[model samples]
Target: MKKILLACSAGMSTSLLVAKMKEAAEKRGTEVEIWAVAQDKAPSEMKKADVLLIGPQMRFMKKKFAVVAEEVGIPLDVIDPVAYGRIDGEAVLNKAIELIGE
Candidate 1:
């Protein structure tokens, strides 16, 4: 199974996106686990994920996250603001798969 993680400011904001992403995975018959975490907890959560996506609002920390992600061999990206604002789970899911070369 592929493990995908999403991080936002307080974690709560991404809850809806997480649900949508899960549904998209189910429909596609993809073996994936998706979860959202607060930015502060991201580093610890990274070890368990195959890919990590940060909310657009947290884009500033991408540089910092990129360094940590590189050390652990996981791809990281800032979610598109337009998709995020509209809660485009499929787009995010596709992005995650692309990032991990799925």
Candidate 2:
């Protein structure tokens, strides 16, 4: 299963989004592992992920994560504020697939 890892300031806010993404995946019958991680945990977590998405609030740190992502060989994208504000699970999932090509 493809793994999509999300990083936010504290991980709590994105938990709800993770739930929505899970539901969307379930509805589409997509077998993927999704989870949220605090920025502090990102370095360790990205190693296990196929793609990494950073919450809008954490966008400033994208460059930092980008380096780690490249080292880990995973595509990293910053979630659009609009999609994130709306909790657009399908859109985010599709974006992840588009980024990782899986």
Candidate 3:
């Protein structure tokens, strides 16, 4: 299963998005592990994830995370603001799968 980790200010905001992503994954019959963590916890969590997606609000932290992501050898990107605002799980899930090259 692919692991997708989303990081935000406090992690709470992305909980719904994670749930939505899981639902999307279920619909697609894709085996995936999706979760959210506070930005402070992201580095450690990224070690266990196949990909790291930052919340749009935390987009500035991408540069900080890029180093660790590169060291961990995983794709990292900020969640699209438009999709995130709408909580479009399918779109986010598709982006994650594409990043994973699955």
Candidate 4:
């Protein structure tokens, strides 16, 4: 199963998106492990993730996350604000697949 980590300011708002993404993955018959974490905790969490997704609120952290992702040999991306605000699971799931080349 692919591992994905969602990073946000407090890890609260992204929890809902996490559920939506998981549901979308299930509907698409894809097996993945998804979790949400605070931005401050991302570095440690990245140790176990295959992909790192940052919420728009954490856009400033993208470069830092990219560096970490590169060092870990994983893909990193920022979620689309539209898809994120609307909790569009399908789009988010697609983004994940695209990032990991799955």
> Ten-residue segment with the worst summed lDDT in candidate 1?
63-72
Judge candidate 3 against the unseen true structure and give its global Cα lDDT, from 0 to 1: 0.96
**Which digits, one per residue and each the tens of the lDDT, describe model 2 over residues 1-102?**
889999999999999888888889899899999999999999999999999999999999999999999999999999989989999998888898889896
Each prediction's Cα lDDT score? Answer: 0.95, 0.93, 0.96, 0.91
Would you give me the overall lDDT of model 4?
Answer: 0.91
TM of each candidate vs. truth: 0.98, 0.97, 0.98, 0.96
Worst 10 residues of 3 by lDDT: 93-102
Each model's number of backbone clashes? 0, 0, 0, 0
Q: What's the residue-level lDDT of 94 in candidate 2?
A: 87
Per-residue lDDT for 9-88 in model 3, tens only? Answer: 99999999999999999988999999999999999999999999999999899999999999999999999999999999
lDDT of 1 at 98: 98
- C-alpha RMSD of candidate 2: 0.7
Best by lDDT: 3
Runs with alpha carbons beyond 4 Å of true place in candidate 3: none
- Please provide, for model 1 over 1-102, each residue's C-alpha lDDT reduced to its tens digit, 9 standing for 90 to 100: 999999999999999999999999999899899999999999889989999999999999999899889989999999999999999999999999999996
After superposition, candidate 2 runs with Cα above 4 Å error: none
